[model samples]
Target: FVSEAFRVFDSMPEKNLVSWKAMIMGYARNGFCREALKLMYRMEAEGFEVDDYIFATILSTCGDIQLNEADSSATCYLETS
Candidate 1:
């Protein structure tokens, strides 16, 4: 489903904030935290300003992965986004 979701997401002509958030959250919920982080980066690269909810999702995803440097990673994510 995640892969399918990505396929659909990639095919979209003009992605907005909501779609990006859904994809990121879906990846995180499905235990694909790394993918979620990557998507967050991609979302920013595409000029989508991640909102507070998305930030929370990223933090939660980082927590799911038990990242040792969650704070630093989040700082980097925030900076990039």
Candidate 2:
């Protein structure tokens, strides 16, 4: 489904942040954290701005996994922002 969506979006003459966000969020919600993070990194590398909401959501997902270091880092990021 996500791949199809990405195909459709790519076919569009104009693309925007929201389109990318939708793909990222879909991956996250579907339990594809690695893909989500990869996409985020790619977006950053391409100079696409990531909004705070995206950060918060990704952090929340990391917290849900309860990985010690990841949770701690997420908490730190949340607290500092």
Candidate 3:
């Protein structure tokens, strides 16, 4: 299922924040925390704006640890949302 999910994700013509969030959240909830977090970093690096859902989902990966470890983009979203 995850493999298929990634297959679709990789084939996306143009991904917005929603698509990124879905894939990341899926991986996170399915015990693929590392992959999820890695994608989150990639998302931020790609200059996508994070929203409340994205921020909360990312933080849920490992409680305050994820937030503490999040880069400036995530913190910016946290402050705003």
Candidate maximizing lDDT: 1
Q: How do the predictions measure up, each by TM-score? A: 0.78, 0.64, 0.67
Per-residue CA lDDT of candidate 3, range 1-81, in tens? 987998999899999878998999988677665567678778878898655676566567645444455445456645654
Which candidate comes out best when scored by TM-score?
Answer: 1
Every candidate's lDDT: 0.79, 0.68, 0.72
- Ranking of predictions according to lDDT: 1, 3, 2
Give the clash count for each candidate. 0, 0, 0
Cα lDDT for residue 35, model 1? Answer: 75
Clashes of 2: 0
In model 3, what lDDT does residue 67 have?
43
> In what order do the candidates fall by TM-score, top score first?
1, 3, 2
